[model samples]
Target: MKALLKRGFNLLDSLFSRAFTPAWNPLYQLGALSFFYFWIVAVTGVYLFIFFETSISGAYSSIEQITHGQWYIGGVMRSFHRYASAAMGICVTLHVLREFAMDRYSGPRWFSWVSGIPLLWLLFASAIGGYWLVWDQQAQYIAILTAEWFDALPIMVDPMASLFLNESTLSDRFFSLLVFLHIGIPLALLLGMFIHIKRVTAPRSNPARGLAAGTLLAMLAVSLWRPALSQAPANLDMAVTEVGLDWVFLNPYPLINSWGPGNTWVLLVGLSTVLCLLPWMPSRRPKRTPVAVVDPDNCNGCGWCLADCPYEAVSMKEHDFKKGHKQSVVDPDLCVSCGICAGACPSSSPFRHVDELTTGISIPELHIKELLARTEASLAKLSTDQPRIMLYGCDHGSVVPDIQSSTVAAISMPCAALVPPAFVDYVLRQDLAEGVLISGCCEGDCFHRLGNTWVDQRFSMERMPVLRTRVPRERVRLRWLGAQGTRALQREVVEFQRELAEAPALIDLEDVSSG
Candidate 1:
C-alpha cells in the first residue's frame, strides 16, 4: 500500500518539488501551501457570504442577483470563492496522502496523523453547507437527506419535517439557525487545520505563487459555470424529481440521496479511517541521510563547509599542515550531511565518496586546483610595497554579498578549524597580505554546531605550542561569523585590515622555500 501510494504521487511530488526550489522534502512545502490556500478560500467565502440570504426562497434569488446584476465583480468573486475552496480541498487531500506516502506521521508525529481525519469530515460538511446556501434543488435534497440522518441520532424530534415540511413549524428563526451553522462550520475547519500540524514548527507554505495562484483561478472558473446553486425553493409537497447535482462538494451526495444516509455515513467513515491512519503506519525502511565527507589535505580549511551544514555536524580539526591549524571533522551522530559543504569546498576536499563511506573525500588533485585558483587570484591583486588586507572567509560566508570582495579572497573550506599552520607560514611570506582574519559561523550557530567550536578548540592553548614553527601566531586570528553576522563580519574585516597595516610583517624565510 505504501509503495502504491508512492507510485501514485510520484508525478505530483516531482512537479511540486520542481515547482519551487525545495529546501528539504517536497511534501513539507506542499502541506504548507495547502494550509495557505485554505485560508484564502475561507477568507473569500466569508466576504461572499456576508451578504448571502438564509431563507430558502430568498437564498436562490440573492445568489442569482449576485451572478446576474453584479456579474462583473460578483462573477469574479464567486469564481474566486469556488476555485479557492476546491483548491483548498484538493491540496489538503494531497497533503494527507503525501504525508502517508512519506511516512512522516509515525513516532512523535502520530497525534497529527490521527487528527487529520477531521479535515475530510469538516471539508465534506462545509461542502454540504455550501450547497445549503444556494437553495437550489440539490440543496433541498441535501437538507432533506442530512436532516433524516440527524433524526436517526435520536437527539430531537424532526422539527423541520414536523413544522416546515408540513407547513406547521416554519419560521424565520429556522433559517437563521441554518445561516449561523454555515458561518460556524468553517470555524471547525479552521481549528481542524490548525490541529493537523500543531507539532510542526513554522508550518510554512511551499507554494511558489505561480502554482498556487493558477490553482485558485482554475477552480474559480469551474465553479462559476456550475456555480453551486440550489433547486427551486424545495417544495415540501413534491416527493421525488429529476435534479441537478454537484459531486465536487460531495460527489457521493446523490448516492446518499438514493442509498440513505446511514450507509453513506458508514462508507465515508470507513474511508476517512483509511486516509487518516496512513500517515500513522510506519515505513518499511529507514530514511537515508545525505551528507558528504571532507579531505583535510585538499581542504583549504576555509570553513565554508561548516556554515552550510544545516544539521550542525561538520567541524574543523587539525588538517594536513604541520602543528599549526586544524582540519574539519564530521560528527557522524549529528550530520544530516546535506552536501552543502561539498558545494562550498575551495580545495573541493569534501565530496560524496563513491567508496565505503559515501562521504566526499578531498585528495591531492582537488586541493591543487583550488590552490592554483587561490594563488592566481592573490598574485593578480598582490599589493606591492604597501600592506594589503588578508581576508580569510568561509565558503558560506563568501556567498553573503557583504563578505565577497576583492580585498577578501575566500579560503573556501570544510571548516574554519582546518586552516593549517603551514598555510599561515606561506601567507605571511607573501609580504603583501598583512594580518590574517578567519571568518566562519558563531560557536553554536555552526550548521555543524560544533564545527565552529572545533575552530575555537584548535585555536586555543592546545594548538598554540605547535604554532611556533609555522608562523608568528599573532599574525593569524579567528572570529565567528554567523549567517546573520553582517555587522560582525564588517567590523572584523575592518579591524583585521587595520591590524595588518599597523602590524609588522612576518619576515621569516623558513616556510617559503619549502612551499
Candidate 2:
C-alpha cells in the first residue's frame, strides 16, 4: 500500500514540477501552503467579524448586508474567508498523506505526526462553528445535527438538542456562545500548529513568495467570480430538508444521517486512533536501528553536530573529560540515526592521519571508517580507466546499485549528507575516482529534511568542512532525482563521465617530482 502511494506521489510530483517548478511546487510545500492559507483565513475572518452581529435575530441580516450592500470589500472578504478555510483543509490533508506515503511519520518523526492529529479535529470544529455563525438554513441544519451528535455522548447531562427545539428556546446568549467558540477553537488550532513543528530544526512556516502570491491571487479571483452568499434565514418552524454543504467540514453529516450519531462518533474515533498509532505499525526501520554516538576524544566541543541534528537529538553539555568546553550529547529516544551530524563534523575529514577514522559524531553501525572503506572498495572494483565515476546516493532516494558498472562505482549511505565534503575531496585527491556524483532525494523532498540542502551548502562552500576549492567543480555533481530516479541517475552519471573525459587531466604532484 505504501509503495503504491509513493509511486502516485512521485507521478504527481513530476507533473506539478513542470507547471510550478520544483521550488514552488504545491505538493512539496503542502505544510507551508497550509500555514499560508491559515493566515489568509484568519485575516479575512477578522474583517468579517468586525461587521458581524452576535444575535440570532441580527446575524442573518448583518450577513445579508455584508453579502449585498458591501459587495466590493466585505463580500470579497467573506468569500476569501470561506475558500481559504477550505484550502487550508485541503493542504493539511495532503500534507499528512504525503508524509505517510513517504514513510516519514515514524520513529523520531512520530511526535510531529501525532501532534498534527489534534489540529485536524480543531480545524473541523472551528469551520463548523464559523458556518453556524452565518445563521442560514444550512447553518440551521448543521446546528441541529451537531446538537444531536453531542447529545449522543454519555457525558451530556441535559440533551443539547433541547436548545434548538423551538423558536422561543433560542437566545442571543446561545448565538454569542457560537461566536466565542468560532474564535476560540481556531486560536487553539494555531497553538497545535506550532507544537506540530516543535522538533523540526528549521520549520517552513510560510511558502515561497511567488507561491503565496499566486495562491492569494487565485483565491481573490475565485471570490470575485463566485462570491460566498448565505442561504435564506434559518426558520425554527420550517424543516431544513435540503441545503448546500461544504464537504470539507460537513461531509460527516451524511454519515451521521446514514449511520446513527453513535456510529459516526465510533467511526471518527476509530480513524483518529488508527492515524495516531500508524507510526508504531510495522515499518521499514530495523528493530534496533543504531543512533549516533559522540566520540569525546575526537569531539572538540565544536557543536556542529548539535546544529546539524534535524531531530534536536544532539545537545551541548559540559564535557566530562575536557573541562570548561562542551561536548554533544545524543538523546537516544530522539535520534533518528540520519548521520547528517557525521558529515557536518570537521573531524570527519579523511586527511586526518589516524589508525581508525572517527568523527566527532557518527552512527555506530555505519561510522566514518566504514563509509571510507566502502567508497575505496567500490572505487577499486571499477576496472575501466575511462573517467571512472564514484556515485554516492542515499538509502531513501535513487537506487544507486542499479546504475553500478565497470566504470562507475556506487555507495549508499543513510543519507547523502552523511558523505562529508572532505570525502568528495579525498576521492579526487587520492585518485580513487576521476569524478564524484552525489545523488539523493529530490530537491525539497529529502527523507532527512535538510540532507540534500546541507550537502549543497557544503559543496558551495557556504557551510562548514567545505569541499576544497582546489578540486575541480566539474568533477563533482549533485543530482536530486528522488526514489524512482534510477534511469535519471544513469543518464547523469554518463553525462558526468563524458564531461570528465573532455576536461584536462588533474595534475599529479608525485609524477612531477619523479619526472
Which candidate number has the best TM-score?
Answer: 2
lDDT of 1 by residue, 354-397 (tens): 23211123323224335435644764575454445555555433
Candidate 1: segments with Cα more than 4 A from true spot:
15-28, 156-169, 216-231, 273-515
Please, what are the lDDT tens digits per residue for candidate 2 over residues 1-515?
87898899999987887798878889989999989988988998889888899998889999889988999999999999999999999999989989998988888899999999999999999999999999999999999999999999999999998888878889999888998999899999999999999989999898989999999899889999999999988998788988999999899998887899999999999999999998887765546578999888989998877877888999999997898989899999988888999999999988998977888899986899999999999898888668999999999999999999999999888899999999999999998899999999988888999999899989999988689888789889999998878788899988888888888776753356458
- Estimate the Cα RMSD of every predicted model relative to the unseen true structure: 14.7, 2.1
C-alpha positional error of residue 155 in candidate 2 after TM-score superposition, expressed in Å: 1.5
Pairs with backbone N, CA or C atoms under 3 Å apart (clashes), candidate 2: none
Model 1's lDDT to the true fold? 0.57
